[model samples]
Target: MIQRRQGGFTLIEVLIALLVLAIGLLGMASLSMTSLQSNQGAYLRGQASMLAYDYVERMRGNSAQALLATSPYVISLTSGSTRNNPDCRTKTVGCSASELANQDIFDWWGNLQAAIPGSGVTVTKANTNEYQVVISWTESDAQQHSTGSQTQNFTLRVNL
Candidate 1:
């Protein structure tokens, strides 16, 4: 009688193949999770950029107050700070430049809080017509397994 070799994979071979497949699947899953986290971080960064730009534009629109000796737009706000919306929005005749500046700050802070909680903002006059805007927030990073959150900052300098 002639001995013939088996054509199919052995049990051990099948088990090894399954193990490799499972490892590959787990790697893919981990990769997907990392991608999602990166995307979320990018999204938060984008939001911060937009918020900074919006605040800059608000200052640019009210350049007179923004460049005043005591500018209302020049402010430093801590996290979770609240501002009362001025009566300018309700008045039909509109409001003064200072009032508008106050309203702008109120609206911007409200929007910022809504978009990113626990965010802090600062706007400082750098020159006669230049200003620096800084927005900061904390983000929990996936890679930081123990030390906790990382702080992110978005800074923009504008000439109005």
Candidate 2:
């Protein structure tokens, strides 16, 4: 009589191993996706901040014609600001609004649609001829597991 040797892994053992592996793989996948998304958000936010600061720099070096304009809300880009992309003709001051608008920074911001896509900038003129350049964009903080946004500002108080 040949005896049957019961030397094999039970069904329960196989199932349990599979379950643990699946859970581990799922956790790793989720972590990878989250990391990718965070990187993208950070990149966008950085670009937005640089754009805002670029505007502030332009304003600091602004020409008297644009700065001293009667209009409190100086939005030259709305007008024929990009009509002329003249050379850096300013000897000791900023370029005219027209020239400034033709700069790369304005071009990067797309159009005067009144808002930056996936972001927003508020160029507020404050006391003592100061300018508050605020840039905002959405991002997720993994530690908090919260979905929200943030605002970064580059304050430039003109020497008036």
Tell me, by lDDT, which candidate is best.
1
- The sequence of per-residue lDDT tens digits that candidate 1 reaches over residues 48-108 is 9999999989988998888887788889998967787897968999898888999999989
Model 2 C-alpha lDDT per residue in residues 4-42, reported as the tens digit of each score: 999899999999999999999999988997798778766
Task: Give the candidate number with the greatest TM-score.
Answer: 1
C-alpha RMSD by candidate, in order: 2.1, 6.5
RMSD of 1: 2.1
Q: Candidate 2: where is the Cα deviation over 4 Å?
A: 1-6, 63-108, 111-116, 139-160
lDDT of 2 at 43: 71
Q: What is the lDDT of candidate 1?
A: 0.88
Candidate 1 lDDT trough over 10 residues, lowest sum: 139-148
Residue 119, candidate 2: how far off, in angstroms? 2.1
